[model samples]
Target: EAAVTQSPRNKVTVTGGNVTLSCRQTNSHNYMYWYRQDTGHGLRLIHYSYGAGNLQIGDVPDGYKATRTTQEDFFLLLELASPSQTSLYFCASSPPDGSNERLFFGHGTKLSVL
Candidate 1:
């Protein structure tokens, strides 16, 4: 089975604070994605990448930044975070074929901005 690990299970920060969330997958998946889950809005994509050093902007990319440093590592950066940016963040990895059914997700990181 594919496994994804995320650091800092929970976080609390003030407005304009800087935050970095990390995710790593051991299954060697080619596609990695960052998403934020909120009430009413459902899961909204923030960013994604198919390979190292590549990033694709997603639906909610205004307040987020993502980077794929290596095949197994993807990072999400929230610079100048605001209260509206506070939500449950998730990291997921999928096979090269980009099948949603084959995606593996992390436990998630809850972030709160005060």
Candidate 2:
């Protein structure tokens, strides 16, 4: 099994806020992703990376930024967080073989923008 961990299980901030969500994977996966889950949008990709020092914009990249510092560490940054961006955020990692079935996910970070 893949070991993925997230920090600050929950967070709260006012409008136009700033927040950073963190994730770490110990399985040495090459693909890391950040996603948000909302009532209507389901799961929307925010950002992703192929490996360390690489980044790729996702479906919802307007208000988000991400960085992959190392193969195990990936971070999501919300510079001007808005209420619309409040949602359950998840981090996941997959092997380099391109098999989506082996994706492993972190518990999640719940952010609330007031």
Candidate 3:
């Protein structure tokens, strides 16, 4: 099974602030993703990467950016964060053959933008 870990489990910041969420995946998965969980929006993908130095923008990309430095490391950056961006963020990893591969998610990172 894959293992995912996130840092700064909780974060608090004001509007127009900045926050960086880090994630590491132990398994050598080909795909890594960052997602944000909100009430009505459900789980929406913010960014993803297929491998090192690769990035793919997701459904919501206004205030979020991500980079995959290595197969096991991925980072999400929130520049000029806003109140609406406050939510539970999750990092996940999946194998290449996603048809039957299950994603492993980190505990979660709760961010509050005041």
Candidate 4:
């Protein structure tokens, strides 16, 4: 089975602070993505990486950065957080190895910036 897990499922921060969300996939997926889900809006891509040490900026990359240190792990960083950045973030993986070819998502991390 394909499984993606995230840490710090909930977070609260000040208007200008730093927050980190971590995700790991047991399936060794090659493509991983970070996205924030807002009310009544579709999932907005924050960042993505094809493999370790490769970062791909996405639509909502502002105020956010990402790192892929290992084939199984992806992390999202919010350097200077804001209330606007407060939302539910999800991590997903698309291994594409015919084992877990579909996008599998983590439960999500709920972030709130005051």
Candidate 5:
């Protein structure tokens, strides 16, 4: 079975604060992604990694960064964050390659900035 889990399900931060969201997958998948889900824009990819120590830039990598320390762990880092970056952040994992298949998402980390 495949599963993704995130810490601090909810967060409230002041603008320009530092935040870190952690993710872990049990499937040992090689593909991991970080995305933010907004009201109507749907899920926008942030950063992804193909394997440990390997990072791939995505459509929305600005204002955010990612690190894949292990096959089962990935982390999203937000430095100098702003209100615009506030959204429901999700972490996902897929098979070795993005097989044009569905992604397994974490419960989500709801972030609010003020």
Candidate 6:
């Protein structure tokens, strides 16, 4: 089974503050992703990576950045956080490159910006 872990679980920040969400997947997969969930947006990908030193900007990459440090580690950065950026963040990993790639997601991190 694939396992993905995210740190802090929850976060609270003021407008213009900075936040960093951390994620680690331990399934030896080749794809990792960061996404944000909101009432209207649903689950929107912010950033993703396939392997170490491989980073891909996702659909909603305006206010986020990500880095993959190793096969099991990935980090998401929210440098200039804002109230509109508040949402539930998730980390997901998919199986190795193949036909039936399944994505498994972490619990989530609830971020509230005031």
The model with the greatest lDDT is 1
Could you give the C-alpha RMSD of every candidate to the true structure, in order shown? 1.3, 1.2, 1.3, 1.7, 1.4, 1.0
Model 6 per-residue lDDT tens digits across residues 85-104:
98999999987777547898
For candidate 5, what is the lDDT?
Answer: 0.91
lDDT digits (tens) for residues 1-105 of candidate 1? 779999889999999999999999998889999999999999999999999999999998998988999999999999899999989999999988735547799
The reply for model 5, stretches above 4 Å from the true place, is 98-100
Pick the TM-score winner.
1
Judged by lDDT against the true structure, how good is candidate 2? Answer: 0.92
Per-model TM against the reference? 0.95, 0.94, 0.94, 0.94, 0.94, 0.95
Candidate 4, residues 34-113, lDDT tens digits: the string is 99999998899999998999999999899999999999999999999999998999999996556666898999999999
Error of 6 at 7 (Å): 0.9
Backbone clashes for every candidate come to: 0, 0, 0, 0, 0, 0
Error of 6 at 19 (Å): 0.8
Task: State the weakest 10-residue window (summed lDDT) of model 1.
Answer: 95-104
How well does candidate 4 score on lDDT at residue 54?
98
Give each model's whole-structure lDDT.
0.94, 0.92, 0.92, 0.93, 0.91, 0.91
* Count: clashes, candidate 4: 0
Candidate ordering by lDDT (highest first): 1, 4, 3, 2, 5, 6
Runs in model 6 deviating more than 4 A are none
Q: Global lDDT for candidate 3?
A: 0.92
| lDDT per residue (tens digit) for residues 1-114 in model 3 | 668999989999999998999999998888999999999888999999989999998999788988898999999999899999999999999988736478899999999999
Candidate 1: give the clashing pairs. none
Model 1 compared with the native: what TM-score? Answer: 0.95
Instruction: Please state the error at residue 29 of candidate 1 in Å.
Output: 0.4
Residue pairs with colliding backbones in model 4 are none
